[model samples]
Target: MRFALSAFAALSLSSAAFANTLESSAGALNITPMVTGLDAPWAVDFVPDGGFLVTERDGDLIYIADGTATRVAGVPDVAARGQGGLLDVTVAQDFAQTREIFLTYAKPQSRGAGTALTVARFSEDGTALENSREIFEAAPGFSGGRHFGSRVVEAQDGTLFVTIGDRGNRPSAQDRSNHNGAVVRINRDGSVPDDNPFVGQSNVQPEIWSYGHRNPQGAGLDLEGRLWTSEHGAQGGDEVNLVQRGANFGWPVISYGEHYGGGRIGEGTEKAGMEQPAYYWDPSMAPSGLMVYSGALWPEWRGDIFVGSLKFDYISRLDGGGVTEVEQIEGDATSRVRDIVEASDGSIWFVSVGDGAIYRITPG
Candidate 1:
């Protein structure tokens, strides 16, 4: 049985301990805790049969069910330094039969580390992953694990899209030769898709679908199957972009934010041929995970966009194509919210890294 989440239990008594009851347009929202005592959890995804899977940035994969959290084996060695370590995890499209899952993280490299994407099959008893193989590894691995931008999303056509960061190298984002600061498209078994933007190009990496990015941490597919991302800016230029195939998203060249110490970034925010962000925050939200609301639980929230604000300690809700911020839901405790997803039963779930717990928001 799923969580018997009701508004009465959460709203009747005044306790902000685990669940919080708040008033909304449609009705009361009951925010309940699913699990606790996690160590810097980065991403969470549900399994086909039962339970949910979570990844810890310190290089651990956990399975939580019936109030028990078990460590799943076969996680690769991650750098676990700076902001690099175990990251996003997603169950395969055909997980029931194939029992496969996809993962992304900062792969330990000689230079320092780079983001790597892989697919693996889970054991029959769900104890360990088998046949793990690296499907794609970002090029020109750099030192200092500042921005790995490791997030993987599967497309409706069975292809995968992986996000790579600038690796603290601003100019590398403009170079098509390296995989840094770009989105890559690949097949399930580490093969390149023929229809990729630069597949037939010379000198450019064939896997690159889009280039000129800073550090995109959150990747989500909208209801229309289009890819959307939330990226962190240097100081004050945090952005949300509608990722397009072969599109050139302006990074250091055209940004709404300035440099760290206070100078104009990249020609003062507007360029001749660079794509503008769908929406941006001047002071920065430090956005991480993104989700396009399906309106399953609350019908009024049909097409809204929800994002985890790392620096702001709250959830920002945006509306439609304009990407305007419509609402901000704050948690009881100060939390560096990491990942967000809509549960199958129509509940909104997210992982708070600073709080070290998982919470679900459902209509009360």
Candidate 2:
């Protein structure tokens, strides 16, 4: 009877929340499941012509256009085990003209061990990657399976910002010489920008823009061209931060969350030189994808941050000064949301890490 009750509860929750409606002062939000049957979709990127490129982690392929899952033939072999494999995907700023797309994944090395972060560019030809080349790779890859910190954003000046995870090694976040736990800025041609924080530092990687981060899975630019990131914390210190150049975002050194077993994570929650988070969740919403909503579907939500929660299974609406309004969306409770992107037509699209379904939230 206990097992039966648990199963019934799961079914009821899944059925009730898979479709949701939000009636707010600005307007109504109708969230609908767009496409389903994906196997651990990791990221979703919008194409110029109203289609999308979706990455499936365990499957090691990029799915394109509607629910059609096509294996891009030239994708490199990935160590698709335990928090690794194909991750984030983003279209280049000049994607329409160049057909260039950026991808992040865990590149497999010897002994079944692998580095968690690598970025590459490929051209879209419907079947295989054309002129694909790796542009960035994490140095001294860690041994564990968690915290890849893979998100790519292109600035208006043609600079790329790539977030790297701390690889579950807290102390590595404070090391300026490594690529792990840092946000790196580079030109489209994979050259470090002169203005990068550590461009002239002796031991530091010139590409590093900012350092001391955990797992920054979500990154996007706002209307003002300022970069923003949402990162996963140990247990409760999930954070939303405004990315600033040369900023030190304290990770293991300072965290609001306790360790997984309920002990303090670091020395304190505040340090002198590190930048404080704009917002943090005590119980950890396990935030993944982030987007600043400027669409007409919910005018009041304009300039607000929309974050997808993986563990809590909801979408959090965050406003200025850390005020948050959480809406329990349907289907997310059973699905781990990997990424969220706003379409050019003002619709919000989200992908699940569990089954790789694509969902859209629009005005009802």
TM-score of each: 0.94, 0.88
RMSD of each candidate relative to the true structure: 4.1, 6.1
What is the total number of backbone clashes in candidate 2? 4
TM-score of candidate 2 on Cα atoms, chains taken together: 0.88
Per-residue lDDT of 230 in model 2: 94
Off by over 4 Å in 1: 1-17
Judged by TM-score, which candidate is best?
1
Total backbone collisions for each predicted model: 0, 4
Which pairs clash (backbone N, Cα, C closer than 3 Å) in model 1?
none
Q: What tens digits encode model 2's per-residue C-alpha lDDT throughout 1-364?
A: 0012113233334534566776644566676665566678888888786567778776455545543445666676676778888888888888778777787787765533333333344544455667776777777647777777778888989898888888778899899877878888888878888888788879888889999999898998887888999999998999999999999999889999889888887778998999999889988989898888775666666788878888867767777445465444544323677788888878888886664477777766
- Residue pairs in steric clash, candidate 2? 17-330, 17-331, 18-330, 38-355
RMSD of 1: 4.1
Cα lDDT of model 1 overall?
A: 0.85
Write model 1 residue lDDT over 187-255, tens digit each, in one string.
998899889988878899999999888999998998898898999998888988899999989887889
Q: In angstroms, how far off is 32's CA in candidate 2?
A: 2.8
